[model samples]
Target: MARNKYDIDEALDSEFNIKHLKRLGTYISPFRKDMAITILLMLTSSALGMLVPIFFMKIIDDFIPNKNIAGIVGVCFLLLVINIINMINLRLKVNITAKLGQNIIHQIRSDIFTHLQELPFSYYDDRPHGKIQVRVVNYVNSLSDLLSNGIVNTITDLFSLFFIVGFMLSIDIRLTGICMIGLPVLMALIFFIKRKQRVAWQIQSNKSSNLNAYIAESINGIRVTQSFVRERENIQIFNNLSKSYSTSWMNAVRYNFMLWPAIDNIATLTTAAIYVLGVSWITNGVAGITTGVLIAFTSYIGRFWAPINTLASFYNSLLTAMSYLERIFETIDEEVTVKDNEGATEMPPIVGDVEFRDVTFSYEDGVPILNGVSFHVKPGETYAIVGPTGAGKSTIINLISRFYNLDSGELFIDGIDINSVTIKSLRKQMGVMLQDSFIFSGTIMDNIRYGNMEASNEEVVAAAKTVCAHDFIMGLENGYDTEVNERGSRLSAGQRQLISFARALLADPKILILDEATSSIDTETEILLQEGLAKLLAGRTSFIIAHRLSTIKNSDKIMYVDGGQIIELGNHDELMALEGKYYDLYMSQYDFLR
Candidate 1:
């Protein structure tokens, strides 16, 4: 089982503030009835467990030496029945607790996924995908262990200790006191061991997170690694990380080894002292104490020490489990910065007009990407934006889609401020095709239908044909049913681009944004796609950002962007007449094309 990074530390935290357990209690509220039943079964199983030792004591004191055959048989039968009952109850308890653990894990996983969806892109921008995956998957699994086995073992251990100690005291207070003499020292040693190893455990946890991150990144970028021939270098780096993790783990283990033996020795000495005292008392004949009672007391002493030992060691497991809870809570506590306004209503159907008025925006505070930038595209008009790299063209497109909120701006679609409308409705009105397109590992039909999941098979094919994607798709071995493995790696770049076009067409968006959509296609395919593009661009307000200036020369307007500002805006002929930024860019590109 993969342990979560948080388990080690959070579990340790529980020792200090057990009240934090209330949080977990609240999380389990929905299944309280099931939990209650599981706890009941656990308590019953614990009772049955304690009964076995008492039964043995009875057999030893009453039936064994007397050779009472009927008494022996009855006791044996009772022991066998109790054993069977204990095993049955234990099985039921484990199964129910296991199910409860799974249900809680499922709920947590689902909540994490839903939260990810609600989170804005900014949250992902600064975080590693591997780290997120670790928290969601590995962490949840560890939490499952903590919730089921951790809880069950802890409750049973406490109950067993209470009953066992109470019974031993009832038999003889002096022996009981002597047997427990070593516990304070053992507990102190446990506290010392935990304190000393905690930092090492924390270091190990951190290294493990790094190791997981490294593996996740390396696997995902294996192509990059192989292409660059960095296999040996990566292996060395991983080895270094593994060594660090091993060293930290070993340090903690060393402390554990030293601490346990020391505790065992102390407990052993205490037991020896008890035996010596008992022998001296029996020899003196002060109080009438039988050899049988002393023998039974000796057995009880062994049982007591073992559970105490187990309970002492259990602190580590408890600490680790609490650590996992901390990490889980940390993730759950993360705030989604962007959310819908209260009582927000969905916008009406779009008529394709879009306007950005005095929009100023920045990803981080004060580092503006777009400043006082404004533009408008009339209904059914196609506007092309020609810009150098980092000229905020994509930023403008993102703004229109409200993928980000502007610092100070009023972006309107069909004359209503975009923020005033529901984000879902606003996004539903736009279609986007980027240079790098995504295709899932599924049938071509399924990939296309992703744009409109409810679209019929006939509709999917019709949409593909509309974008001139049908010929290439049908030419494949399985036609529309052919699987595209791993982001369409089985297909060519142009093929993926075509599928993307088909998807956008299926969406039938009112506003279209194409960011270097034809940049990766061959000249022949690009020329063919231009015909389809003309049809797709009709009846929609379209914004095209491209370095291929000739492709959008016939667009209603051309905007030349430089240094985060629109330097020129006019028709093709008008820009050529000006001989400004747009003219220079076109002339420079003309030399290469020619």
Candidate 2:
């Protein structure tokens, strides 16, 4: 299926001021009925609130003139009752808005997470981990605020404007007309400020994302920065990003801070004009222009300014909030290039025979990483692939696991093309240990069990024993319970490798790929690892990529790959007799020994 076309970066800038938000409105569609009821209650609250000024007008115009204490008390009590009801309605509206915002954000976060998991490894290769991390966290946070607070404030402001205007006209039409005279001017100002605010907010969000991306990269590569003594350079880069972020924020804040006061000053001037004109008319002579009516008009005027200010401030808030929404929507719009085929079947159990038939592959177009490579590893046999640093040895292993597909060719495991089977099932039959084995932060037992989460404690201990790691594990302070700090920083390189070895051992796959596994370990640990390897490769089909020929000397076959093609294939002794690529690589190491 073709992918959705949503520009995440642009959306972030515009704050999702697009058709998608209208579509996303459907998420709230389910609760529309409840929302309707809540809005009705809010309207009722607004209506009751308008009655307060009328009650005061009545007290001043009628009850005060008649000197009726009972009437005065009754009107005051009704006003109090209306105030209580309005408060209750407002609280309920807030609660409902809160729930709706949380639900939508939760749904969005979950969908993005699922999409990330479904995306191909190529997508990961192009984007950094820190960049993805920021998107998942900060983007989701922005979406929640936009949907929740932004929507609620907007609706309330509209309703308040409607209710206030209607009540003012009902009380006195001419005075109401006079109060609304400056509205068009205020609105034009608001529109102009909104544009400026939106731009500033966009700048702020972009700068912030850039700062976060840099921080993430710097911290992850902190070791390299220190080793190369690039700390000063890195700090200068951070300072530049931080300055841009702060400047953007301050620009947005400056505009936002000025907006409310500007609106207030305009409203104050309008209110003063109304009071002066109304009083002059009352003294001179005009219809329905009583002192009480003038006072009530002033009260309504004050009420109108509050909502207008709220709306103006909300416009600024929307820019920041919407920018966040755009970023989140962008991620949701991302295409998952790698997805399962509709009729893909689960891989059945196999005897681990593998074949690459006239295979050609590349990580990039026009540059082949492996070309016309054809080889086979029979069941229960060990095969070694010897190659120069970038001769496509690891690429071969990746192809076997289907981490990347062939550009033009077929890969078969037990005579079935791997693409015909579900990727999860295909991977289930294989175990791999890369040159740089990663150990996550967790207890030693937890890290090992990560290979197969359902593995029993007994199974875990047995796997550790098979990899010759059990004794060293027991000698640690807390044994298997010892915490492996972030990236297993607390453990030595050899110890980390042993733990990874134990992890792979626990998986118990029919096919195993070990790439330069013994190269990084100390001699003592190397001996322990070799002993473990003997037990591991005994009756399983294995593929080994190693720099040390001694590690794979006893393998059934050794294939020497050069220039993306296998130049020679034979057992170790046969390769030595040929005195070709294999002999040269072996002798180079022998010279170091001499």
- Highest TM-score against the true fold, candidate: 1
TM-score of each: 0.91, 0.91
- Compared to the true structure, candidate 1 yields what TM-score? 0.91
Q: How many clashes does the backbone of model 1 have?
A: 12
Best-performing candidate as measured by lDDT: 2
- Which ranges in model 2 have alpha carbons more than 4 Å from their true place? 1-17, 29-41, 86-96, 190-200, 254-258
Model-by-model lDDT, in order?
Answer: 0.77, 0.81
Task: lDDT for model 1, please.
Answer: 0.77
In the range 133-231, model 1's lDDT, one tens digit per residue, is 777887678677767666666666677778778778767888888887787877677767675665555556556666777778788778899999999
Candidate 2 lDDT tens digits, 1-594: 111111122233333365656756867687677667677877788778888888889999999999999999999889889988988988898898788888877777887898888777776776656557667888677667667766666676689888899889988888888777878887787777777777777777767777777788888789889999999998988898888889988998998888778778878888988989999989998888998899988999988888888787677766666666666667778876555567999899978899999899887789998899998888998999998988999889888888887899899999999888898998887888887879999899999998899999999999988777898899999999998888788888778888888887788989998887777677776777677789888879999999987889989999999888989999999999999989999999999978
Runs in model 1 deviating more than 4 A are: 1-20, 193-199, 252-263, 286-288, 305-314
* Candidate 2 clashing pairs, residues 3+ apart or interchain: 8-330, 15-322
Candidate 1, run of 10 with poorest lDDT: 1-10
